[model samples]
Target: MRRRGLAFIIVALMLGMLLAALDQTIVSTALPTIVSDLGGLEELSWVVTGYLLASTVSTPLWGKLGDQFGRKYLFVTAIVIFLVGSALCGLSSSMGQLIAYRSLQGLGGGGLMVLAQAIVGDVVSARERGKYQGWFGGVFAVASVVGPLLGGLFVDHLSWHWVFYINLPLGAVALFVIVAGLPNDKSQTRHRIDFAGVVLLGGATSCLVLLTTWGGTTYPWSDPVILGLAGAAVVLLVAWAVAERRAREPVLPLELFRLRAFTMSSAVGFVVGFAMFGALTYLPLYLQAVHGVTPTLSGLHLLPMMAGMLTMSIISGQIISRTGKYRYLPITGTAFATVGLLMLSMLTEHSSLWTMSVDLLVLGMGLGMTMQVLVIIVQNAVDFKDLGVATSGVTFFRSIGGAFGVATLGSVFSSRLNDDLSRVLARTRLPPGFDPAQVQQDPTAIQRLPPELAADFLHVYADAIATVFKVAAPIMLVAFALTWLIPQQQLRETTKAADLGEGLGATSAERSSLAEVERGLVRLADADLRRGFYARLGSLAGLDGIAPQGVWIIARLDGKGWVEAAELACRADVSRATGRPYVDQLVERGLVERSDDEDRLRLTGEGRVAAGRLTRSSLESLRGLVADWGDSPQLKRLCERITPELLGARADRPR
Candidate 1:
């Protein structure tokens, strides 16, 4: 496939991922409005909990299915299911209906998140994948910021129903783009679906989620229903383990745990998920119920955290890709997160939004450093055969942690709030008909209460949420400790498939040549080196005042003769919005000119001269880098022939 085609596919996948990740947070700000309209006050947490439960349970199953069938069709199918669920959710008339529809949406969401990573592993080399995975993190950050605001906008201006309705058009565009751009490679090997394993695992997960959701909320901790669910979960999980060990193909192969990298990555992922979701879920409530902010303002308040996450994620990805070192990043990240969570635990009703935002930013930085790197680590550790399962396993565990965190922390918050509210109401007189439950259910009800009662309610909520963070702080410490156990595995420069193929044949001398090429490839793949090389090339081209991006646009015009701005942006892996500024800058510099054909750009004579210099400088740099290799034509020929083949083999594999 051409570079342009691959870039388009990646964009489409990002959009699909955005659709799924956005849904996770978009409903959060709207939850109060949803409860008010649907009248499921006590059952409010179920709105998020239900979707998480279904998505978590289905994650590994979707990965296994994608591994068996082709990923393209499976991805498209997931998008379609998500869209249907989204439309149904918008049409829901009752809270129960909404919960059910959200679960249906989750069933498809599992695939959207996992398969996107899996497909990238299939296409890109491991060395180059870090930068691309950074884009995935960027998508999550963007979604985290946008989803809440969009949800708030919908709830505030349009009806909250538009939150779900908005997904329809986006999903439609993603579906069309993916079907058209993503290549399908049908699995040639026969695959046996692990029916028994899926059933046992699904049952076990459902029971665990139910236990967490209902424990100490709907039922006492010692209630027979909760006890029975807990017992059944343990039994079902054991059975699933047994089934996996004996099955022809397991949904989650037990063998993966044997790798320290895989085990540690999964463990860290779980704890990070617990801390991340637990805080994000409740922070909005703090803003609305305690600070009396509107939903829109609550969304805006989260921007600091999102900004921290985005910055650190990109920076860490670039460093990892450049240095090929990773174990310490997660460790440092967890430490930051621990400190942030500790700070958050100290918050009182008097705490300001700025203080909260700073704490969240610290937590976000910590999470950003840890989350995507762990996935990359696990993917690097596993073979191509296990890539899909391994990638999905990380997501699956993280999501499970999220479901447990929300339920368990919610229980803590509710219990503490209820006790505090009871104490406050016991000492003070209330309006005759007002129920204390209304304060717990509706933020609007707090506003209607007398000043003293409302202040008491705010204090109780603030304290309860603080207690939740206090509980989570220790878990972050544990995650930090677990990072130490992650064995320092050397990050692979080539995809697993490429590595396997190269080892299959060739003389000892040829192997030596390939080793040299591998080293060169690693240096070539360094994100910093690539950026510097491009920057140097631009300067050498006599376009020193122009930005690197503008030079890239000029180069593309020189190579392709004439292309539209949209095509240039796609090929350059930038948004059209971002590309326009570079194009305008280049036009102003007289390096590029508007073509005779409408909307196309072409290089001028000055641009051609600059392009010639850039080409010569780039070739000279490459030659200098390889100068140490003995001037053997045979060895040179082998290196040149094998490198592209290795890349092509990896890219062509039907992962």
Candidate 2:
């Protein structure tokens, strides 16, 4: 349709994306207050971990469901589920209840993020979709930067409950706009979803997360409960492997492991996720509890990290795009991450905010450099048929890594803090009737103590956080070691390194090989156009006489083959009277011809030659987008297939 209608649809989709993306980071700052209100400081990580685990497991299911069914109503259902979860979370009275609700919310959040991207393929054509996909990616970047700050604002100024409640109004607006503006899905393709694999994998992951979360903190290492979970984890993992091998469409194909690149990327991705999530979860506690900062200021303190991550991600992508060599990035990235985590481990209650900022910035930059490149490496490594699954698989490992990271590190923090608190509380005298358990459950309770006692408790909190990072640092070193196994692969011309948005907001939307290429090309084209792309392309095509609009007309006719002369002006978005002169000029230049009846227009022999030249020009310019990728037959064929569509009238426009 109309531009207005498309605009509304996009707005609604963006809002849905924003809600899902925001929830991922918004709760980080709020976690402190949430624990203060609900008790169970030991369970703090689960609030984020539950959401992550649920979302990661559900992503494949949602993607397959949307394909088997239609995305429109499924997306609507996802929004409803998300809203309901948000409502329940806001009303939760216990840590357990909040964690469960967050998981429920995560189920919908997965759908929202995946479906929103999938919906774009439905609403926009391949040639023009690149720019729209970029917009969606942009939504993720904005969410990453704003989610924490917004969460802090709600927790400090409003109630912590408002963090979840905020989704209500936004979800309602998105729901309304989507229903009104989105078209009905007419797709009938069916897919066999790997239900058994999903179930087994989910069970396996849950067992693993719980084992890590409770191993030292909730139960002794030798506790039967812990041992049983370990046994269950191994058994479930074996079962999942069997299910994946037998299933027609596995959640994560076992065959991917055979590819050295895929295996290495997944390993590195997992470690990055582990470190990134561990930091995101605990840094706020350090700020609010140890540094005595407000929730909002804690969020503000995170900006240096965000800036560093975003900056390095872009810089790394551009460098890869230009050089077409990326093996060194992961190696460099992991090194930075290991050092950063080590730096973070050194932080104490006496540390300055400036020192923390530098440490966080370094960590963010390292993660930013590493995370975005993994997907690109996987995409280039796998066969075309594995494109979608490979892309999602790498990110899937990252999410799982994050879950494990938070749980594992949280266990470290809880164990250390409890031990220290027990020993210190026994030696020091407290006011009559003050319960030591209160201090164990809430760091804020330390402020109720005498000044000297409170300072000691803050030191305990600070030391525990430091130990968490200390444990995390070596894990990143493992990722650094794993990166060496990733053999340097040639960057295919069609392989576009993910931009800041896609890198930050990793989505599970599966597209065909050509579709992926087209999306990347369109994004490259949009970026190029802003820098006088068409003029350069026209010069390359030897059409210096034609304006950019004229080049568009030539491409339009070439793509359509022929068009009714009477409809040309409207298709061109110009008036018939005003367009006649332009048509005559093309005819005079021998680039176009009128039919015998003069009611239709078609490219002349000379016009066809110009179109062919223009196609070559388009391909050349596209190659320029990835500067160093040498010429290839595959690149030429892809460029030819999409150039006309890229230059023609948008497929979604009103006829």
Candidate 3:
């Protein structure tokens, strides 16, 4: 039953993932048709690139917001945005408008991937997560296969708008399952937000993306437009890195990178992304343009690639489950990918379809072996306190690398195609007024081209794609080499039982430490009335009315005729101790008077005055306290009637 629920959860998250994954592929199949209708070939790539740029920019914002509030609301909100974007996309009539709308879709798509993967990691243990992660490759396979099929169906019989329309229903289902079935996740709680660091990072990342998209395609590398952006990106990125080091709560945890293995692995993941995007983005184009197949047939040709993905993913998962060693998977996976890409470098317009399929299978096998494994490696190499940021940081860099690879590789392909087209045009005669700009900007121009010229132009496109692959293969080879640095540490096989003593029920040493803190004080008055003080004053109480000077002593000692016996006897007429004798009798009867020696045994003025005046320290000092206590002053006054009894009736009366 637990497994069943877990499986249901996995399926739900995959559905969210499919919304983004399918968009990437389905749109690719339908883009040519949309462009032909919209007639803006010059701006064709932006429809894809703009979405990526917007999505990448918003990724961290979603992650931070989720950390601040709850993940569930944001998850639901992300789906809503995606659905809205999809609706807007279907409504767009112009290429530029479509690109703008797709960016809105990218914003939500970005959140879905980051939070969906992060939320899964929260619930599942890394050891058991292998099977679920393998399910990602499964979704990737399904999306990869279905995207083109659905897009083809929509384009052939229905309107191409259905490609975008399809996302609304799927995304709605994903939103429902996530919002209704899943528990409200608190894994993203935070105390302080690094708003400053976020701003710096967003600015820096924006500059970098702009540089990547514009460099080598717009103006020159040294042009102010390119140089200024590139330089600003570098400066801001460095500044952001430094700022994060001092932050109490950093947007990106810099500490994980201090560990050499994780640092290298994250770098390797970024490089791995370069290879992943380079291949994934262009393979369909290769299958179509080079193989002379329609976009729909080309998507079917990718089945071997999907099979390769499933085969490697499941196999790697089972092996990791059995042996627990995981570090070597990425290292080996990148190696196979490099070798596969090397095989595909042999691709040509006339290359055999079977050969291309086999080559792609190898590439897919390599991807399956490696992609999800890097996330596990990153999580392992960091402290548990840093789990979310560290995990997101790794994904962040990978996304960055994909954007980098796509923009640069795409630009290169376009530039090279233009070069090839110009040369092909030069070789053949054309009308004197034929302008390249007009031809390049208009999709309708492709249909009007002379037969040989059309083939020439397409040949240039085929070579341009091959050129990117040639460049990309070497990059993959480098990534394969870097994977060697990935430590062969095993996936931790079990969720370690939680250490229950994280808070409050602390150890004895801690209790002792706390005790020392609370048990302290501030300085107080020096008057602590000592023993025998009252007894010392009793003798003086008896020596009264000797003289005016003598009276001073009487006044002084008049007070303490009333306290503890030891204090009363402190100066007791050496006689008072002998005769419980009415020391009371002497003082009250005035038979014996108090001393007159100045200051000889004087009490404080207030005490003397209180004793002599009240003949009762009893009524005034305690009057208010006792009145409230006993209901009335007279009743309170009566309560003290027991003093003689308290002093002892027999002792007080006769002796």
The numbered model that scores best in lDDT is 2
Lowest-sum lDDT 10-residue window in model 2? 646-655
> What lDDT does candidate 1 reach at residue 4?
85
Per-model TM-score versus the true fold: 0.73, 0.91, 0.66
- Candidate 1 least-lDDT 10 residues: 500-509
Clashing pairs in 1: none
Distance from true position, residue 245, model 3, in Å?
A: 1.4
Which scores higher on lDDT, 2 or 3? Answer: 2
Model 3 ranges off by over 4 Å: 1-14, 39-45, 114-141, 173-188, 431-451, 495-655
383 Cα displacement, candidate 3 (Å):
2.9
**Candidate 2 — which pairs collide?**
none
Question: What is the TM-score of candidate 3?
Answer: 0.66
Q: Please, what are the lDDT tens digits per residue for candidate 1 over residues 58-103?
A: 7656766777777888989999989999999999989899989998
Q: Who wins the TM-score comparison? A: 2
Candidate 2 on 1-655: residue-level lDDT in tens? Answer: 6778988888999999999989989999999889889999999999999999998899998988988899999999999999999999999999999999999999999999988988987887656677788788888888888788899999988999999999999999999999888989898458788999999999999999999999977898999999999999999999999999988878888999999999999999999989888888899999988877888999999988778888888898889889998898889889998999999999988999999999988898898889889889998888765777888898898889989999999999999998888888889887798787887777767666788878879889999999999999999999999999998877876576465666786445555444565567677765655565556666888988776666666777884566986677777676777666667877988999888887788888988888889887876676665344335456557666556666655432222
Per-model lDDT:
0.72, 0.84, 0.59
